[model samples]
Target: MVNWFWKRKRPLTRTLRVRSRGDYGDVRRVDFAELAPEIDTYLGQAAYLQLGFFETLSDLIAPTPELSQKESLSLAAGAALLKHRALVDVIRERGDDPLDVMLPFREPLDTFRRATHGARPLETMLSVQITAGMLDDFYLALSASYGATGKQVAEILQADDDRDALVSILKDAIDSDPEWSSLLALWGRRLVGDTLLIARAALGSQALDEEEEARVDPVFTDLLGAHSRRMAQLGLDA
Candidate 1:
């Protein structure tokens, strides 16, 4: 009888893995009727939709106090969402990591520039990307070295200063002593971050501009002509 019971019986198990903490799939489902500010629900749901998973960076590593935690999480979540959206859009277009698409096409573009000798459209694209790269670098340097305070970085970028003078200052400081290496590294990182910020800001400005249609309305017909002329001059095809 013991053998029969043991053979017939089976162990029972029950468990559920909850992947999300929120009730809404998107913005509209949130209940805004409560008297309290709904920023948590609003931001949290946006974060989940963008990331597919959510965790506070602080809590993931350390014991953060309750008072400032949510705000800090929301700030990171906002930046992450922007990154995710940009990456997804680029990946959809190129079937590769967004970095491959978004990075300034310097070497290839420079080669084409040298071969073609200052052709108009190629030059325009090169100029834009160069400016974008500079902005990205600036932001990166300031962020990593100076605590990532957006306002302070913005003030630095917005300051009216000569680029040549800044470069000279940086180079002199670097050559002055070995101790300056850390400062130089920080400066280099800020320049990279600034370049990224430039590209994204330009992307946003163009996205919002009413004049966008004036260029895109023709469906990039002239772009093909510019591209073919430039590529042919460089002896590149396909």
Candidate 2:
């Protein structure tokens, strides 16, 4: 039932650069103190969105003993809440108003959610997964561009416990209904596309270099590769 949409002919490891020291040589160093407000803005909105998504997911999943004991849906929701609080804490520590920091991004994030509303729990989970993974890549890519605090926030935002739980649920769902593989695969693709569009719009508003913009396509290709691998792991076609 695994239908691969495309296969990468060559490896992409070298194509997509992470936080390598060499890449930072010519790049202008972003002052953490100056950038802290914007950083908090980004993370706060992200934390709010993720927490809401996890809360909705917690309500959607059936309370089976296996799911209850192992995944503990409430734990995922709680984790997301805590992450939001932590983001707020980061903002407060920087002496910024958390509400003001997150206010600008609220509209775009809401619009994204409204535009990409899923019809099923599986699709919802996949959307979360795609967004989470892409954000991780984006943060990691830009980690060195900012200062040490930026790196710290990037690492903090990279937590994937809730996403991991969603993945387990997705795998189990696919296993139970192999016939849904094709549909789910299509959903995954849609999620990836929508996520990228939203990300582009969001990050485009930031001050990025021409070099960074040029590097986006290759990094996105790497994201697709990672998404494909994740789909394959769930016995779905990429």
Candidate 3:
């Protein structure tokens, strides 16, 4: 069942507004040591989510006989696995147990998956694009606030192959059936709504400070802008 919240048609900026100030937060510098634990936890959840996405993709592609399509799917899944391993390695290097760090997130992530489970291939792809893109944007914000280590992990997490592949598939699908464009645009909106809701619930649990809260609107704006660009790239309404 789709959540009622996913049906909301509010603009992203309005939905994600942290406060009425509309002022961007100054990028406060943070050392790796200061944010290490939080970063580790965030990366662990990200790694787990990526692996889950691959598993979902793998299942979807399993019965397909097209070699080229299979190859692309495999490559995307392989990239996700590589990202997972990199995140785990970083967590271990930080002297933290990766499993322990990710444990708290399992429930929320699982809930998100269940809530946003797509009924169609295009819907699934849009969900993947929105979820992965939002995570990347969040990491980018962290990288800017934190130092070199955060930057390194953000860079490592930055892989557009899967998104690019999905976009191609979406474009082909929509082009073949022009009527699909409208449906997909709606699906994309639902995906974005659900994703942001899940993100807010997860991050809200982390108890962000005043400055961190102040950063929310700007990061959300960046994310929404990226989503718009992606939708435009695929010839879908943002």
Report the number of the highest-TM-score candidate. 3
Q: Which one wins by lDDT: 2 or 3?
A: 3
What are the lDDT figures for the candidates, one per model? 0.29, 0.57, 0.62
**Which RMSD does model 3 reach against the true structure?**
7.9
Global local distance difference test of model 2 = 0.57
C-alpha RMSD in Å of predicted model 2 compared with the true structure: 9.2
TM-score of 1: 0.20
Compared to the true structure, candidate 3 yields what TM-score? 0.76
Looking at candidate 1, the ten consecutive residues that score lowest on lDDT are 1-10
Query: Mind giving the per-residue lDDT tens digits that candidate 3 earns over 1-238?
Result: 3332211111112112221111223333332223223454456667777777777667657764678767767777777777777878877888988888777777667777766667876677677766776665555455543356666676676654454677777788899999889988988877787666555443423444676566554556666777787788788888
lDDT of 2 by residue, 1-238 (tens): 1111211122112222344221121222322212222455445655666656565556555734464534555666666666677667777887888787777666666666655556876676676666656655555554544466565666666564455676777787888988677888888777776676655543423454566565565555655676677777678777
Which pairs of residues clash in candidate 2, taking residues 3 or more apart in a chain or in different chains? Answer: 3-237, 5-238
Q: Where does model 1 exceed 4 Å of error?
A: 1-162, 205-238
Best by lDDT: 3
